[model samples]
Target: MADHGNDPVVVIGLGRFGSSLALELARRGTEVLAIDSRPKIVQSMAGRLTHVVTADSTDLEALRQLGVPDFYRAVVAIGTDLEASILTTSLLVELEVDDIWAKAVSREHGRILQRVGAHHVILPEHDMGERVAHLLNGRMFDYMEVDENYALVKTRPPREYIGIPLGESNLRRKYGVTVVCVKGQDEEFTYAGAETVLAYGDVIVIAGKIDQVERFAELP
Candidate 1:
């Protein structure tokens, strides 16, 4: 058995989503056991991941042989095979995997995954669509969804917030958002405090509900 001690992650599937996710995790220096039922797909990902194997994840015996339950995290990235995806997730659940992150094609798919004990369900296309819309609209420099209703927003300080101390801005009170850090052009993010002054080119990272964050970004 490989020493997968550092919270190794198992990824079931070798489709676009699965392959990309496995590659990213592997690149980050995390131990990733990447699996797929297709031989060519497994062969293509051979050296790109920690370990790539060909096996039907829907088979409970196959998963057990691969030690899927031993890993702390598992991601179900099965492509368009919804039945296989759900079955794989179910097998993970039966084996009592600690954290299961499953990708779903739609909201209903996500709900079903959650119903089957997936710790987190992701609608990649829908989530990516929202992110793309936000980026194209130029409403914020960057946006990250924190949950269903909240987000972390990064943007240039509004004109009025410039040359003003963070304490006096009352961002949390007035805008229902909180500025956590600030960074000047070509500078790293620094912790923002009450006396921290905002500058013209300063980028502020704030967290709040999506609607409130949008309101804050609209500040002129």
Candidate 2:
């Protein structure tokens, strides 16, 4: 684990999501100070994290005394407890923490967190929806929108094109899309070149105008 000199991170809840994030951050060598009102919850994660405090984070003074304002950025992740989450976020802002990230259960909740000075509001459900949509859309292993007209796309090799050489297929000439890399079945990926061979289960990462990529994907 290597520290990146990030300000220590404080997580204000010990529920599934918050606990998981804290553990992951700790595993990555980031100093984490976790808090939960429930003694049992805090106790369970003790020793694994840098610090675990059993205190209500909505209390501004408690947060300040814990050195949250001076030593760490904080995340308010109290899902299902809307009031607590909002209060904690407001307190963190008042205390002037360097940065605050919050999780919201709905659009209205997100708006409120943003209005209260949360630097980032994440809607996990909404993000998961986009991931699911991409998985269901064949020819799209993963897709990131760069703009209205361009995107970076990852796709499995089209059935008819497997075993073909990059130069012979002339994918760029035919579809105006460039293959950025090819991930083969052996789990090795190489930047596209004339000598690269497409194999079964290979995934191709391509970047181009959105419509061109879509047109290319549609080819068998």
Candidate 3:
């Protein structure tokens, strides 16, 4: 069909998640059409976005009048009103939008959104809570779950791993994790290799199963 990858995105709702997503997209120079049922919210975002409209997202005609169907991507970020969120997502699905992302407040909401044809359902609160929990211990500098049960984590090299070349360290064999990249205290991040020696104050990003990576990070 068409290459909708770079097309402008239509974002519905103006709550924390929707507003943040729209603003960030616009800041990155991406054209964004932000929609909300409240006039004040639309007014607040008038100059901040490419286009801001005060209209009911659940109304297909209203969306059509704003040219939402012409856009390739749509995000239904109405987290509070379940009926409105579902209706908006269903309309977008009927419009055959190439990519539909909807935010869900809970697991049941997410399931409904997926059943209604939202290509992607994001539980922002749940996800953020999980991520924050992982970073709370201070052992991990950063963490991203790549897939179910798999994650990539940035952490300081374990005490025993300090001053040892990766090949000789046998990290993957011993800890069941592979160091993907390393950044020394005084050097920029670089792709790690077998001969890469990790020293104190160095940060390394490793990839492996979530439990194994957690275990490795807790090594003494």
Candidate 4:
């Protein structure tokens, strides 16, 4: 297990994503260093994180003073500030930060971040819009992206699969997907297995490559 309690995570720009990330890490026993240019934002998070500093992350010297590069992980959660975001990410790379997570405002911004050495770039609006569209279309009950090509999805067991044991369905052999669990209509869950029977109203939790997972979701 990774010891999140020891290695601290540094979060920059205390906007919606940054503040939420810091608080959640702290809540789960991970030490967090939260930084922002805004005094109000830093002050708001005081005592909530291991340390909160009001400093300009884009300034190399300011980041050096905060020991930002010492952290194995750094998050650039700047809000709608493309220049600042890129500058901060560049500094992190220059300092050899291992994992850099950045938020991009647009496709171009994302490309730039990648070029500048951001290990992970997230476009929240674009990703969320696609997620909502999938759920609204009714084919998928819920969706989560594990990576560019992998995903974990929850959808009702295909109508024809209900009342049959998964062992006989040959789902894994046919679709290359695995059912991790089955959510019963009563809201309880059980570990899925070959012998476990699929029931009406059961939400199947399947994980695999996106294409396989979606194909399994459409199972009849």
Best by lDDT: 3
Tens digits of per-residue lDDT for model 4, 1-220: 5754457889898999889888998888878888899998788789677789999998999998888878999889997888999999999999999889999988899999999999999898889997897678656888998888888888888876788888898878878888889988777878898898988878888888988887777666
Candidates sorted on TM-score, descending: 3, 1, 4, 2
Off by over 4 Å in 2: 1-5, 142-152, 159-178, 193-201, 207-219
Candidate achieving higher TM-score, 2 or 3: 3
Per-residue error (Å), model 1, residue 152: 0.9
> Which tens-of-lDDT digit does each residue in 99-161 have in candidate 1?
899999998888999999999998889988998888777658889998889999998888988
Q: Give one digit per residue, the lDDT tens place, for model 2 in 44-104.
A: 8997787999998878778878888775578898899999999999999888886799999
For model 2, the local distance difference test gives 0.84
List CA RMSD, all candidates: 2.9, 4.0, 1.4, 2.5
lDDT of each prediction vs. the true structure? 0.89, 0.84, 0.91, 0.86
Q: Global CA lDDT of candidate 4, please?
A: 0.86
Off by over 4 Å in 4: 1-6, 172-177, 208-212, 215-220
User: Candidates ranked by lDDT, best first?
Assistant: 3, 1, 4, 2
